[model samples]
Target: YKAESGEIFAVNPICTHMKCDVKWNTSEKSWDCPCHGGRFDCKGKVLTGPPAQDLEVVNLEQLIEKDNS
Candidate 1:
């Protein structure tokens, strides 16, 4: 999760459709799955097909646990 305006927002690094890693595209302000082309906006909204569901917004608690592990 990235911190902004005193709050945090983050998503799972992997895509839901095929378990592919989604990389951040700063220039495009979106996440794109390299394997299947699933796309999500920076806000985690579904921007393209193949993956119908939106990316999950990670909570602060979850993010803390992940960091600990």
Candidate 2:
């Protein structure tokens, strides 16, 4: 995610609510969930939601390794 200061960050694509996948909103610069109107900031903090928690951070390298296996 891109902050107002232009800092970039990354977080999991999954929503904390209902385990729904989140989509990036480039214009708004946040992750949004269609399932329950959950919203997360670039830092993965909950902006608004049926979700009550921040988005989880995932290890990309581990995920890549797992995918290849």
Candidate 3:
């Protein structure tokens, strides 16, 4: 996710709770899992439980390089 200050944060879109897919919560600016109500901040830090572990952070530079290959 890109913050208002122009900082970028990338994380795995899977919830650590039950391996469910996480969707963006625009109003809250967080990632929310519909299956278990797990919420995470833009940096993938757990904001609410059902999820105790933070999401895996993805390297933005690696992603960009891979996309260009």
For TM-score, the strongest prediction is 3
Over the stretch 10-66, how does candidate 1's per-residue lDDT look in tens digits? 787778888888999877778999998998987678899688888887786966899
Candidate closer to the true structure by lDDT (higher is better), 2 or 3 = 3
lDDT of 2 by residue, 20-62 (tens): 8999988888899999899898778899968999999766678
Cα TM-score per model: 0.73, 0.72, 0.89
In model 2, what are the clashing residue pairs, if there are any?
1-9
1-69: candidate 3 lDDT, tens digit per residue: 899999999999999989999999989999999998999999999999989999999999998999999
Model 1 TM-score relative to the real fold: 0.73
Per-residue lDDT value at 18 in model 3: 95
Candidates' C-alpha lDDT: 0.81, 0.85, 0.95
How well does candidate 1 score on lDDT at residue 47? 94
Which regions of candidate 1 fall more than 4 Å away from where they truly are? Answer: 1-7, 61-69
Best-matching candidate per lDDT: 3
How do these models rank on TM-score, best leading?
A: 3, 1, 2
